[model samples]
Structure formats: C-alpha cells, structure tokens
Target: MAAAVEDFAPREIVSSRGARITVRAVRPEDEDGFHAAFLRLSSESRYTRFMSVVRDLSEATLHHATHPDATREFALVAVAGDQIVAGGRFVAVPETSDCEFAVTVVDDWQGHGLGRALLTALRDAAAVRGYGRMEGYVLSTNLAMRKLGARLGFSDGPMPGDATTRLLVVVLRGDDGRAAGG
Candidate 1:
C-alpha cells in the first residue's frame, strides 16, 4: 500500500545558519525538484551517498525515489522555498523489523544541520510505521556522516564484504520499550 501524502507532517526549522527550511514527505509531484537537487550535488557528495560515481539519476531511479511504497518504504525532502535542499528515505528489510536508510544534502546546504533534521524526521516516521530499527551503509572516508550517526545514537561496525564502508544501525524506541532489534 502507498502511504498517503498526509501521513507525514511538514516541519519548519531554522538551520544552523539561520535559514528557515521546511521538511516534509517526498511526493510524486516532486520529481522535477528532486532531480534538480540531484544535479546540484557535488561529485564527491554523489559518490558518498550512492557509494559510486553517479553523474546523474536514471529515469527509473527517479521514479522509484519519488513514488515510495508506504508499506515498506518512506522518503522525505527538505525544501528551502521551491528548492529541495536535502532528502532521506528508508526501505524495510524483508522478514525483519529493520529498515535501511540513506540521506543526502545539497553541497551548499552542508553543515547547516539539515541532514540531521531530515534523518530525525525519517526515524520518527519509520517508528510510527512500527519499524524497530533503521540502518545504512556509509563510506568509510565520510567522517561527517559517521559522526552524525554517532550523534544520533547509531552503532557502527565494518560492513561485511566491504572494507570501504561501515554499517550503522539505530534501534528505534516504541511505546513499550526499545524496538525489536535493541
């Protein structure tokens, strides 16, 4: 089932540099803006996020990104006026209460705390959907992301079969207690 657009609430926050940005769910109508944001990413940023050198997003990738399956996937975008400055998402792991997530912020917007905000929103949304944990693979050289993961309470370890990346996982909390994997 697809998650209704209204399922995610929009939030307004002031960045570290004092710019007000809105964070909300990614909608089908955001394809153009999303693509534009991808274009604005620096080559290194793209490589860090995708774990490879990706100069452009393919048609199918764009479609899947903007049209998330509500039951097993969730995505959000941070907008500064008409521009998408950052985005994040989580896809559920089959037969498990965990989801793998990814996040990216535009080069100009880096260090403004937008990435952290987007990630927090993603975590909250996933918990609401009953996901007990969220994880992601970060390039070993991306120290900023590793720090952010630590700040967000995620534990990290070497990714099996990949020396260039590390796996970070955060156990979500539920009403009863810590989520399943915790």
Candidate 2:
C-alpha cells in the first residue's frame, strides 16, 4: 500500500466581518463546523458546486475534504455567527506543482463576496507555497462561478465530453498584484 498523505485542516485567520475566524491551520476542533457547513448546504447549491446531489456527507467525508495536510493541500473556512458559512480547498497534483481548487459559500451567503474572498485566499496561499498555476472544472450552468473565475483570471474551455462542464486554468505568479494574498 502507498503511504498515506497527511490531512489538511484550515487555520482560521480572521473574517472581513472583523470577527476572528482562524485560517491559520485546521484542527480536529473543526470537524463539527465542517459537518454543519455541508449539512446546511441547500440541495440545489450542493448540486451546483459538487456536480452531484450530495445526498449525504458523512463526518469522514467532511474530514477528508477539510483536513488534508498543508504540504499537499490548503483549505480555508469562513465563519460568522458561530457557523462556517463558506470554505475552499486546493489539492496539489502529485506529479506536478500545479493544483486544482474549489470554493463554496452557503446559499444565503451567495453573492456576498465570501466566495471571492475564499478563492483569493486559497490562490495566494498556493502561490506562496510555490504553485505556478491552478485550475478547476465547473459546471457550465454555474455562470456565477465561471464569471467569478474570469474575474479572478481564469479562462474557459469545454470539459471534453461533459458539455455541462467548463475547464479553466490560471497562472499564479508570486508577487502578482492579482492575488489577495498580500
């Protein structure tokens, strides 16, 4: 069997709300918030984001997504009013330094800039760690996400065979004024 990679948990730094949410590193303490965030996800939003129904997300599943090791993964959560309303992750491809990313914001929080913040945070974090680029496959129906990606420097193409999806990639140069990492 292959050696297991370390799991990553986001460290809460702070929220734009001025409320303290640590983005420093993820810990076991985040399990509950992680679960609740997924549970609270509306079915439609879940489908939109995950490209699946997301009928149920067990604790193990949540842990797998939220708690990857910092070396291969970087994740962040957005919290306000004692709940994690948003979060994101970037998974480093083993064979290369590039990464793939996804961001989520609870339905009520949609259009509230939380998604943008989460993406910016993850992109900067990836760049700092020496990732030269990042990309994602988003459903074509998710014009909002596509638009957000475009605003953040993503370009689009057909997701080969799955016409409903669009693939996009962007380079993340360190010191690039484009990222919110500073």
Candidate 3:
C-alpha cells in the first residue's frame, strides 16, 4: 500500500562532520526556508540542479516543491536548526512505474552526507508508494552528482539527443523484487 504523508515523520541524523540535522517531509510552512535556501545556492549549483540559470525560485516552483501530493509526489528536507541544509524529492512519472528524483544541498553543507540521507529517505518513501524505479536527468559535466548517484546504486548513460545530459536510474523493489533514492 502507498504510504500516507503522515508516515513521513521527522527524523534526525548526524552529518559526516557530526552536525545534528533533522530530515522530514516538506511542509507548507517551509516556504520561507525553501526560498532562503534557494537564494543561498551558488550560481553553478543552481544551474546544475535546475538545468538553468535560475536567479530565484518562482511561485510555481515553490508551490510544486512544498505542496507535494501525498501519493504521486513526495519531498524531503534536511534542516540544521532553523535553516534548510538539503532537500530531495521524487515525482511519479505518469503511466509508468518510474519516478523522477532530485536532490540539492546548500553551498555550505555539500560535503556533510546530508544528500545521502535525504535521498535515502526519498527512496524509502517511493518504495512505499510501489514505484519500481527512480531516475533523474543530470548534467553530464556534474561529476559530483554522478558520483553520488553511483554510490547510491544508480546506473547512468548519456541522455539521447542531449550530449550535455545523462539519465541516472536506480531500481526500486516492487512486489516482484527489483531493488530504489534521492
């Protein structure tokens, strides 16, 4: 059965640097924090994550990020005190057993393992929803993200018709037994 939104209660984790952090489902109340985190991302980070030179998060993007549908869309955020340090999410692909996933960590928090935690949470959430796989389109030049995805069991190949992009996928276990992430 698909897990409900309430199933994703807040949980705490310690980063590689030993900083305490909380990981939880993104809530409507997180709008301001999300905005702040977006603003704090470096231009290169923004471009790599969004595939564009986004100067700011638009209202539409904020809504999509914060107001995820409990079933088909799920999002997670990692917080240290009052600030969002990282975020991850997966959205079900229509008419398919796969979902698209994404993850981002604040500039100052990139090397702390928060990305792994956030993605793990996302993968668990998607599994409960019966998704068979999770995937993302990453920039071919983004070696850091590619490396992270590889560590999480994702396999990648060049995105057809787009030499600058690659598709990364991780199989998630379904009833038939397959294997899922952020």
Best by lDDT: 1
What is the alpha-carbon lDDT for the whole of candidate 2? 0.73
Cα TM-score per model? 0.92, 0.81, 0.92
State the lDDT of candidate 3 residue by residue for 48-95, as single tens digits. 999988999888889878888876788889999999979988888988
What are the root-mean-square deviations of the candidates from the true structure over C-alphas? Answer: 2.5, 5.1, 2.5
Question: Per lDDT, what order, best first?
Answer: 1, 3, 2
What tens-digit string does per-residue lDDT give for candidate 1 at 33-143? 999999999999999999899999888999999998777788899999899999999898988778899999999999999989988888777776777778999999999
Residue 99: error of model 1 in Å?
0.3
Clashing residue pairs, backbone N/CA/C < 3 A, model 1: none
What C-alpha lDDT, on a 0 to 100 scale, does residue 38 get in candidate 2?
81
Best-first order by TM-score: 3, 1, 2
For residues 6-125, write the lDDT of model 2, one tens digit per residue: 323444444444555544334457788878888888998899888988888887877777567655777677777678888888888778767999988888777767777788777766
